[model samples]
Target: MTRESGRYKGKRVIQGGRAQVRTVLYMAMMSAMQCNPVFKATFRHLVKAGKPKKVAIIACVRKMVVILNSMLRDGVMWDANTAKN
Candidate 1:
């Protein structure tokens, strides 16, 4: 992904994926932020490391996608403890 200055000054935009996919991932992230412990921890870790909130959110989105993909490839179900590790 690439970061660019957004129309609003001081805001950064993440660009690079298909808009529809990005939109869907953003939606999933909203839910993940509310209820997924692993995702919440990941977001908190990034922000605590000084990353911008949006940047941290995008990182979580990417992580979710990767986890989903791997689960599909391996025919495994979601496991919070495994995911946390």
Candidate 2:
């Protein structure tokens, strides 16, 4: 299976193997929660709701995938604030 990274430069980075890609994606998501302001806020919001940290993190990761998908489909640039809109 081939994973497309979309345009010349986009958020999606396809790791070589399927399993490896999943692992890498999960790690990337974790890093985003720490380094990306939007993701960090979202994660904190989820935590404040009494959600399990693991569950909230997974949800954030899923959101990231969806956002990446939308960007790839629409050929839009990454805008952290635009994601919440």
Candidate 3:
């Protein structure tokens, strides 16, 4: 969450999606954070900035979801540079 945890907890991330897709996206995001330069740097920065690892992971996963949605909407191929932007 962006502000205080007390104010943000349980109300931060949206929790509505197909379980199967969520699981796959979570796994893919984890793997990407490990090997993809974009996600790796983001994870590193979040941790360095004092975010808990789980929080950082969730943030990355959310980002991936947004990127994926935009790609699908635009009918564009996946491109790391475009996603990063």
Candidate 4:
């Protein structure tokens, strides 16, 4: 277990996006992990698969970013079915 041991780990969202944007996204992901059906399920799945909590949260954040990008690009509204797809 030679992995760097510390309170900090991994690069922040997309290697240099706006700080405010990342902060807002991080907050949203945290809330989503607790309340949003889609993200809550994803977080639980990742943790069940042996990922650490922080790691799972980051993964959710990335998933959210991709979902947001795709929706924006396609000019679609948020849909529960779309989260599954």
Candidate 5:
């Protein structure tokens, strides 16, 4: 409750308990890069094509949100290895 009571509740932060959201997003992206073949390949391709690493990370984050939304709406479990838009 305390964490969510602050002015930045439900927002991204670099500090405080509320920072978990950003941390989790970052971790999810990193995890996908490590274990999700499709994401890994996409990220590598992006980087190789001269897209900055940071830009690629942001792309992965956006993709994660879209994938999550699709899976939730469709009532499906995610298969990161084979999942590609």
Candidate 6:
């Protein structure tokens, strides 16, 4: 699958993905915002670095997916310290 990133009127726009997956990611992101310190820090860092709020949230969602995938692949439990790295 191809990922597309662009700007419209100075606003970042990210597109290209399954709608269902996108929905799930967004829901997970919302939960992460409340309960995941790593994700919360990632979002804040991105926004502080000049990224848009939505962009930062998307970044966190991507990070969450990667972390989850690695956890499953390695048959390991979540570790906050390891995830930070």
lDDT of 6 by residue, 1-85 (tens): 4444464255435566688999989988988888988888888889899997887887888888899999999999999999998
**TM-score, predicted candidate 4 vs. hidden true structure:** 0.75
What are the per-residue Cα lDDT tens digits for candidate 1 across 5-53?
4564565556776899889899899899889999999999999999988
- Which of the two candidates, 1 or 4, achieves a greater lDDT against the reference? 1
Candidate 1 vs 6: which has more lDDT: 1
Each candidate: RMSD: 4.1, 11.4, 4.4, 5.8, 7.3, 3.4
lDDT of 2: 0.83
Report the lDDT tens digits of candidate 4 across residue range 1-85: 1334476586543455577977898899998888889999999999999998888888899999999999999999999788865
lDDT of each: 0.87, 0.83, 0.83, 0.84, 0.78, 0.84
- List runs of model 4 lying over 4 Å from the truth: 1-18
TM-score of each: 0.80, 0.72, 0.73, 0.75, 0.69, 0.80
Off by over 4 Å in 1: 1-13
lDDT of 4 at 43: 91
Residue 60, model 5: lDDT of 86
lDDT, candidate 3, 1-85, per-residue tens: 2334555555355466677987888899889987888889888989999999888898899888888899899999989888777
Please say which candidate is ahead in TM-score: 3 or 4. 4
Instruction: Tell me which of candidates 2 and 6 scores higher on TM-score.
Output: 6
Per-residue error (Å), model 5, residue 33 = 0.2
Q: Candidate 6 versus the native: TM-score?
A: 0.80
Off by over 4 Å in 6: 1-12
C-alpha lDDT (0 to 100) for residue 18 of candidate 1: 89
